[model samples]
Target: MQTSNDIRTPAEIYDELFVPALFQQWAAVVLDAAKINPSSKVLDVACGTGVLALAAAGRVGTGGKVSALDASPEMLGVARRKSVRIEWHEGVAESLPFEDNTFDAVVSQFGIMFFRDRIAALKEMMRVLRRGGSLAVAVCDSLDHSPGYSTFAKLLERLFGTPVADAFRAPFVLGNPETLLSLCNDAGIENAQVRQHSGQVRFASIASLVSTERACAWTLGGMLDDQQFEELSREAELALQPFAGENGDIAFEMPALIITAHRP
Candidate 1:
């Protein structure tokens, strides 16, 4: 599974598939545990497009600072354009560019699951947090609970083949609570609480969804050439036929996990 950073031009990748509502959905989870305050210093790891970082900045107020880091230069570029106050930097989760006890809170949204070295990344997150500081992260649950993706995945597998579907499932690593908890424990984070939440992932239309997937180039990247792309698109349209309503509107349920922990 390729991490978001590993994908070429992650910033554009996000802007395409990750709609504004999706950000709001995940931000609610991240903010709930973030406990942002006027004096808090925040760090957002793998801060794609600065969604969480921007939300954190608003919560922390002008007195506080937010450092948004990502391995992809393109991602940082998008994040930079969003806000000048955010200290955007190019860095990986395994080796964050920050001092120990530097931040009052550390957060990530849909990022922890993609780290090549999950344990190392969590430890690094712990290292940067001040004593008793909180760590809040949002990750997707398994595809079973994620209706939109699950259906899309099944269709892709049946039509485009299993390999194409496998690529999409790669990034959803922490879809299980036990697996997530084990990773946290390995990183020395204890007493973590996991919460389940549901959000609506709306698509303008089936064509729009397919177009966005093509633009992101994560799941379908390299796997599909021109011919395959057209075939997959047609297959997806057929699969989505059942979901189409009178107005041609389609929405999918996106279930996510909000995992929060406090540094000892």
Candidate 2:
């Protein structure tokens, strides 16, 4: 099973390392919020490696249909290899390639913060949703809401300055409920509900936690040089000790704001 020719891309590393630790657990939560039925036509926007889409396909069974779209072809490549039943598309969130009133449920997880036009993306999600169909979106809660990451951010600042710390903090930019609700309103989405759902950020070790973020483009990828990465790793081993278990596993509460709405 081991070979010198085996080279895993960054997307593959993301799917392999990040999905199970951070994202896979949220699939059911998203599907539940969207009320995925056995025959429901579901669309997963910014589907990443298709964790949510794979789960949706399972829920829909043979009669239902599940389609996933992401901006990354590399990610879509990994997702396609995992399952052949679900439809996979490579596209941006703001301009979804689907007909209006086509989907019974639309869901996105932790992808809204990075969208070029968040309001346009939400509007597109709504536009493609049939009347009375459900939409669920999940985004990381603010850095302030997560003490572990708050500490980690400060550590990054100590080691690499504010820009690097800010890079680490980008995903939490949409953590504020008011800001997210305002986005919904701006997008003309009626009666959108935003609720904070507590979750855990776990890694095999402090090293795993730090290394994953190092490789993640969403976090600190391409920002740290080799020495800087080593410095951060050395610092993080102690800085993140509070959340580490006896087995050296890292665990902390990292809540997310889940926004749910229906097309009226």
Candidate 3:
């Protein structure tokens, strides 16, 4: 509990901050689409802090098996502390450390976009899934679909220039359904069904959003000094006011694409 040099990893920060703000709401949707059942054996790929893994584990219950895989040891460490029953493996998505035709369902939530080689990862997901086993994945939609993030990106580009702020664009790079389906085809995964899903973005206020960004958003946070950040927050508030309610609550719609397929 006491540490001077124990730096918090991105996985730790993601589990504590972004999970509630974003990932938790989508985990069930992903697992449900994968059709995880009490007797199913499940695997969550790129399972940052194991949100989807935990949800699948609950659905699978005592009779089922659940394994969580991530490229980050830090992330796996965080996941292990939360659940010991499920197996945790540190590995990349492109080359899963598992045997072929082993899982009933393989699921990933908001993690497909970050894979270094999405096509290879897709193949690996298929490789590990048994015949007729399902694969379900969710990825954030384009920037325009998320008002708060769009405004923040506008601000980021203004402050840091387009090239740097473009890093923020990575998550939405595969937002298109056509692109998703095409990638699966190229990867030799067949009959993938791609569909859009809408969800809500919620924060107590614009200030709360700004504060969270400052504290945890690595890409754009800490680049500006205190005074500049405060000014940026003020500007962001004005820009986001249309979505703010009378009680000053911030809420907006966010879209994502969910892709599902089964092995031949």
Candidate 4:
């Protein structure tokens, strides 16, 4: 599924569907962990569709500066549509565009796992942050611990192959606390603190989950053939049946780590 590395869909789907489904749960947590102030200059690294960045902008008010960066122009375009006050840049996290000590805080949610050079990105983030400024990053726990994604990946593996299944598992690769701490130490950021956090992911129905993945999950969607898709869909429905709620909503607990530290 790495072959689909550059795949992209309408960015609206991400802001509308994916954000509400998962990322919104941790948006406030990122700001709270970072302890950002109204007048602080902030940078949101890899700010896909500007959820965290927008949230930060709200906190910063007119006195503060909020800048968001992502490698994808498509994502940035969607983010730009939402707010004109927040500065949006198109760039990779490994090499930030601004000079050193530019931002009072740096935050990212579920973005670090995909960085090509994790330590380089962390170092860049630290370099941009002022002394005593905080860093807050959230990485999803392993799929084995995430019932919804784990079950979907297993179904994909059974239906097609391990490559696709492994692709589903990629986001959770850096979930371990040791990895988070190690990244900080390697980046030369001091006094790192990693916190384990659990949040409930609620979907209106299993169909909500399925439809979002089918359209926007770059690693999994548009790979299967006609017959294969039918088989996968049927199996997925069966797999989700046990998790359905009284109102047909599907809710599952997702484990994640919020790594916070300050530049010193």
Candidate 3: regions farther than 4 A off: 1-9, 214-218, 221-228
lDDT, candidate 3, 1-264, per-residue tens: 422112555566677767877788998899889998999999999998989899998999999999989988878888999898899999999999999999999999888887789999999999999999999999998888898788877877886688646766667788888899999999997789998888877877888776566555435444566776678788888888888999998888888899999998
Worst lDDT run of 10 residues, candidate 1, spans 1-10
Q: How would you encode candidate 4's per-residue C-alpha lDDT over 214-262 as one tens digit per residue? A: 6665455666655776677688888977778999888787888999999
What are the per-model C-alpha RMSD values against the true structure? 4.1, 2.4, 3.1, 3.6
lDDT of 3 at 181: 90
* Residue-level lDDT for 17 in candidate 1: 59
Best by TM-score: 2
Clashing pairs in 4: none
TM-score of each: 0.92, 0.96, 0.90, 0.93
Over 192-227, each residue of candidate 2 has an lDDT whose tens digit, in order, gives 999988888888998887878888877888899878
Q: How would you order the candidates by TM-score, starting with the best?
A: 2, 4, 1, 3
Task: Report every candidate's CA lDDT.
Answer: 0.80, 0.91, 0.84, 0.84
Candidate maximizing lDDT: 2
The TM-score of candidate 4 is: 0.93
Estimate, for each residue in 79-187, the C-alpha lDDT of model 1 and write its tens digit.
Answer: 7888998999998999999999999999998887778898999899999999989999888788888777788889778877888888888656578988888888888
Tell me the deviation in Å of residue 176 in model 1.
0.4
Clash numbers, per candidate: 0, 0, 0, 0
TM-score of 3: 0.90
